[model samples]
Target: MSISSRSDKKGGFRRVRFIILAISVFYLAFLQSSVMTFNTAYVVLSNETSSPLFNQYQLGATAALLNMNQFDWSPTYLPLALHRFPLDGLQRSFTFAASFAGGLLGTFPMLYVLKHVGAHVTMSIVGIASCILCALTPVTIAASFELFVGFLAAPIFPVIGTVIEDWAPMEEKGLFVAILSAHVELDTLFTPPVGSLIAEKVNWPTVFYVQALVCAFFTVGWMYFYRDDPGEHFMITRDEVDMIHRGKTKDHLMSPPYRAIFTSLSIWAVFISAIGTIFVGQFMDVFSPQYFTSVLGYSPTITGTLTIIPTIALLPLKAIAGIASDKITRISELAKLRIFNSLACFLGAAFFVVIILVPPSTNSAAATALIMMPFILLAFLSGGFHKAAVMISRQHSSFVYSIVHIFSMLALICSTFTIPLLTPEETFEQWRIVFIIFIAVLTISNIFFIIFVKAEPAEWAHVSNTNEFVQLTEEPRPKHQLRQ
Candidate 1:
């Protein structure tokens, strides 16, 4: 093909890839967020009459930070609020933990299924299962169904990682990884406010029903439109497929070296960073709706609107950072990862610390900005440890990514249960302690990431055959600029 012709074909396929990624990522993320936002109504649900989905789901803790339940211990302590119990941080954490139980189960299956069934098939099966689970959540087994719904999330992104690794041009691989990751925040953008609206206007059950319908629409659209191989896609031209292959392709996947993966400090860095990311990320994402409604005294509708706005701002910011990371390739990918990860971790901790000190406020915009700034800073992870995992693992990227998700799952469990225990009164003083602990976790995790993070592929990421696939291309640099 002529140079101009190849260029044209390349641009066309890149556009197609982006569009497909967007459709697939947004829908899948939306599905996962739909599962998560069930907790948005946790306080409301728990306070209502007991059921399998609500009070029955919360069997243990009764005291919340400053609620009247605290007086059972102290005679002199003044109650901050008069709220009923069984919905304290511990209960909330356990409910959050249920999803991880499914994640842990699905991770091993993901490896097996992708090795055999293909990405499109795995994603389709997961999507359908999620929708079914969401639909079934109205029954007395809602919590169980919700747990099953979590299984859908486990393999979905790993499959997406494999597909993106196959199609994204070499120069744009990191950009694609980061861009696709926007789904993490994207789902949050929708679920909090939208879920709250449905829960308020209709009922909590209606929220799941709406999610089921949306999930079905996206799932079917993906099943119809996506093909396992670029060459097999009917909508794509042969030139487009060729262009994708010509740019970057992973024609074979190898069995990952488990010992290397487990022993590598670089891999541990990514996993550890994931723990901090999920802990701090969910600290705001999962619990904020409840916090705004309970502690800050906002209605659920207002809380939803306020909570999602930061994420809306974060999406474009994350994309911009991704593009910038891809465009500014001279710095070395390892350096870039450290810089971005540090900014995310330290700045997020800084924001959280500031919020702990922030006096109570009623002004919606200003208060929301202060509250959500830490969340907005999470945009850096796309350029940081997230992209690093992909770069470092390559052919075994799915397993590495799955490990990151597993770390995130474990961190979320700790974060979920930890906060409630620290701030049972939900008082500002108790919140200070919570923020301090989170900040410490963030700082310590960043330290390890900066110390051990790697950008080049690990020894275990070798291809099955000598397929001559392209390694990630960084912009040309001086010989000394390369790290060992």
Candidate 2:
């Protein structure tokens, strides 16, 4: 074929592959959304249940200790007899902590699974396991079992990082990561209200059953439709395969530079930023519904609906950040990342302050809107950071990203413990202190990220013995000479 014709064919194939991968990534996001929705709603459902298994006074006391504002010490009536599970403040904290622990435990195992089984198979296995666990949650009737399910689902996330690194073109990495990261907010958009309605009208158990069934269908779909590498996909045209082979780094499968990665300052900055981000994010996920119910006096349904506001606002901001990051790559990658990160943190911190200053008794609509503002603004920072991790070490992206995620899980565990300690009584006044702490952490982390984090690939990432970094400008090798 002529050079021009070949180039045209490659371009067409690249577009096709991009679309397929994007859709697949979005599907993965859906699975993630389902699991996170369950986690987010679990605490709310457990708290609303009036079971003899739990002590209302103990919960009251803990809430009082953590939240010094006026709280109703009276027990709520359970709509169903089966709804009697004891989930006092301390117990709730422990349950959330267990889930975080599970996620942390799955990190190393995810790396091994991704390398051996490949992203598609690994995601399929984890997806099915998590679905089964969700289906069984109502029957199991124990928080411990729920925690185990969280652990199983935890590895699914790191695998996504691997897939992105392996498949996404370098130029469009930000956009791809943005779409994947936005799934969390997307879940927040629909799942909270839907899950809440199920918990309210029918029962919490029904929510799990429905999620399980949906997950099962998707799990099978992924197995049949998705492939780790485009070259292996039956549906991909030869032209598409050639495009992928030409674009990807040869060193992708080589042994990772563990020593260099571990010692890198940029990696550490990403870790610290993740810690700050996840700490606040988990606090919202695990406790925001409780906050609306206990402090703002909203019903479960209203709380669920209200949670969607921040999520809706966040989605577009993440897309904007992602697009902007990709478009501004002519600037230093580090500069783009730092600019977004610092802006997000500063603006998010300001919003948090506004949330804190707004009294709970202010107009309910206004108060809720103010409370959601920080989450929406902060979403930009979270999305940008994910893209930054990809840029810093594309070959070892999964491992680096997983390390940050594992630490974030640790932060989640710590937040579960500390949140209750800070606002034992579930009062807006007590929650103010929590928001202030969030602002401080975000500010500090952003400052550190701006000062230290670099977006260039790590030295070790380019130093593999068997394979070398592929330059974007390098000439494509003869198809026969390409590694299959």
* Candidate with maximal lDDT: 1
Model 2 CA lDDT for position 19: 59
How would you encode candidate 1's per-residue C-alpha lDDT over 1-484 as one tens digit per residue? 1122212122234356766777777776776775675665554355533222333344455533234333232123523121223456655655666777888777878767876787788888888888877776654324455577677778766765786676666567767877788777777766766776776666666777788888889999888877766655655553455556653435445567789899999989998988887887886776786777766778966775777777788888888888788889579888999988888899988887777777566454555677788778889888898788877777677777777777777787777678878878776677778778878988999999999998887767644444653221323334343221
Inter-residue clash pairs, candidate 1: 62-86, 64-424, 65-424, 65-425, 65-426, 66-425
Instruction: Choose the strongest candidate by TM-score.
Output: 2
lDDT of 2: 0.69
Please write out the lDDT profile of model 2 over residues 1-484, one tens digit for every residue: 1222222223323455565555565566557665555554565455633333344434576673454223332335533324535456777656656666767777787778777777778888888887878777664555576567657766655765776776666666777777777756665655566776676667667788777777777778778867766655555554655445454466666667788888888887888887888788876667888888998889976776776667777788887888788887477787888878876778878888888877878777787777777677766774457777877777788777778767876786788779989998888889999999999999998888878788777777653444433322355657654433
**Residue pairs of candidate 2 with colliding backbone atoms:** 51-84, 63-424, 63-425, 64-424, 64-425, 66-423, 66-424, 67-423, 67-424, 67-425
TM, every model: 0.80, 0.81
CA lDDT, every prediction?
0.70, 0.69
Clashes of each: 6, 10
